[model samples]
Target: MKKFIIAIDGYASTGKSSLAKQLSLHLNYVYVNSGSMYRAITFFALKNGLTPLNKENIDRLINLLPEIRLDYRTNNVTGISEIHLNNKNIEGEIKTLEVSEYVSLVAEISEIRKFVVKIQKSFKNKNGLVMDGRDIGSVVFPNADLKLFLKASEQVRAKRRYDELINEGYTVEYKDILENIINRDSKDTKRKDSPLIIAKDAVVIDNSELSINDQLDIIIRLINSEL
Candidate 1:
């Protein structure tokens, strides 16, 4: 059986990662979350107080991306490969709102995108993989066999994000979360390097009103046909 590369691209907190992971496991394919590459960079920036304006610093960061290995270690109980950055398990830290603020800023850097793209390509060489990020379908893996662009209304995505932050013990406002989502969408779409856009051949999954199981079924059917 020939394997197909599944590329899922979407905005933050849109459940793209969850769906991608499930599909990968079901199909026995490798699952890669490309956004974590940028998040790991932001984690480094915050630790070193490196601002986005520092072009040289960003370039230095790019040079170091190869050292930031994103290993996924499944939990002893929950059975999920928690994201790890540079031998350290920073999944809890990377989910914070501050990381959210800087991710787009860092992602907009061309050098950073170039560096991350290099890693993404290595994982897709055999094509039995599912990768999700803002640019996977349109830029990083445009030749992927299947492309999914997931989206929802701003209000819906914002509320989901707000609840996620609260559950994570962050003191945040719903209004602020909504605004942040809007700002991120604008920034992501306006980004110079591989801006977020629906590819011409991409299948649009408007998950605005669907449950996870329903969404999974729809996508599974689409992929099964191709496989």
Candidate 2:
């Protein structure tokens, strides 16, 4: 069987990561949750006190990008990658509301994208890999054998995100999350570098009305057809 790159692109809380994980497992491929990389960078910037406009500080931080390592680990009998920076696992910390708020800001930096893209490219090498993120299909792996763009209504996505955060004990308002989703959608589409766009040959999936299994079945069918 020839290895191929699988790119999943979508907005926040659209279940891109979840579906990617399932597909990777089914195919025995490596799964890279690209958003976690952005969140890790956001956590680093916050801890180092580098605000959005602090170019020098941000550049200095990017230089340390090589120290970031991500790997899947079994925890509590479930498998998920532990994101490490300089040898310390910051998975739990990086998923906080603070990191969530500033992640898009850090992600807008072209320097950071370049730094991470280099790492992502190396991982795909001749691809038996599943990678998911905002611009994965269009930017990170444009030539991927299979590409999917996932989307859902703003209210639906916000509700899902709010519920997830609430379950994790994060204090958040549903309306506020909805507003943030709109704001992120704007920024993600308008960003100067590698803005999110559905690639010409990709399939668009509106998952708002679909169950997880439905979505996964659709994607698996698409992948099979593509292959």
Candidate 3:
């Protein structure tokens, strides 16, 4: 069987990562959460006091990018790849609301995007791959075999994020999550470089009212049609 790439692009909290993870497992493909790469960088900047990104800090972050090492290691228990920074597993650290707040700002940097994109492209060497992020379909893998742009209403997305954080033991307000989602949507779409736009031939999946199984079925049918 010929292996192919699936690129999933969407706004924050739109379940891009979740759907990509599921698809990867179902197809026995490599799964890459591109947003986690940005979050790792943001976490690094925050840890090193380089955030609130002004011109000076941005330049510093760019210079410091050389020292930042990122890689994915699959967990034996879950069989899912988790990102590591500088040989340390910072997966749990990068999922906090604080990281979410700064990740979009970090992703907006041109140098950072270029650095991450170079790494993202290398994943194509895998036998098969499923990658998800704001610009995966539009920028990273424009020729992907199947490109999905996921969307959901702000309220639904915020609620989903809120529930996730709460279940993770973080006390968060739904209003704050909603605001972050809105802000991220604006920043992601208006970013000067690699703004989130649906590829001309990509399929748009409005999963606001759909379940995960429903999405999986739809994508499976599409893949079968392509085959």
Candidate 4:
């Protein structure tokens, strides 16, 4: 059976990662969360004080790109791939709201996008994979066999994200999460490099009212037709 590269692109908290992971697992393909890569970079910047407060700091972070290393390792207990940065498991740190707040800023840097997009494209040479991020379909894998653009209203996405964070024991306000979602949407769409845009040929799924199983079924049927 020939395998297809699946690219899922979308705004934050639309469940792109969850959907991509499920698709990859079902198809026995490698799953990569491209956003996690950016988050890892943001996490590093925050820890090292290379924040985007000024151009000088952003330039400093850009210069240190060569020193950063990112990879995924399957967790024995969870049986899911977790990101490793600098040979340490920073996956736990990368998903925090702190990283979320900074990831879009880091992702906006053309240098950072170029750095990560190179790594993202390398996965194509290996085998079939499912990758999801803001620019996966538009920039990283423009020729991907199946492209999906997931979206939901800002209120829905923000509620989902807030619930996720709260479930993870993070103290957060719904209003703050909503503001972050709105801010991220603005930044992501306005970024000069690889701004988040639906590919012309990509299928769009507005999953605000769809259950996970329903969404999965719809996508699986589409994949089956493609296969």
The positional error of residue 155 in candidate 3, measured at the CA in angstroms, is 0.3
- Predicted structure 3: lDDT: 0.93
* Model 1 regions lying over 4 Å from their true place: 52-67, 74-79
Residue ranges of candidate 2 with Cα displaced over 4 Å:
63-76
Give per-residue lDDT, candidate 3, residue 205. 93
Better of 1 and 2 by lDDT: 1
- Candidate 3 lDDT, 1-227, residue by residue in tens: 67999999988898988888889999999999999999999999999999789999999999999999999999998889999999999988898989989888999999999999999999988999999998887889988989999999999999999999999899999999999999999999999999989899889999999988899999999998875
C-alpha TM-score for every candidate: 0.90, 0.90, 0.98, 0.97
Question: Whole-model lDDT, candidate 1?
Answer: 0.83
- lDDT for 218 (candidate 3): 98
Q: For residues 10-69, could you state the per-residue lDDT of candidate 2 as single tens digits?
A: 888898988888787777787888888888888877887776547787777777666666
Which clashing pairs does model 4 show? none
What's the lDDT for all of these models?
A: 0.83, 0.81, 0.93, 0.88
The TM-score of predicted model 4 comes to: 0.97
Best lDDT among the predictions, by candidate number: 3
- Location of the lowest summed lDDT over 10 successive residues in candidate 4: 73-82
Candidate closer to the true structure by TM-score (higher is better), 2 or 3: 3
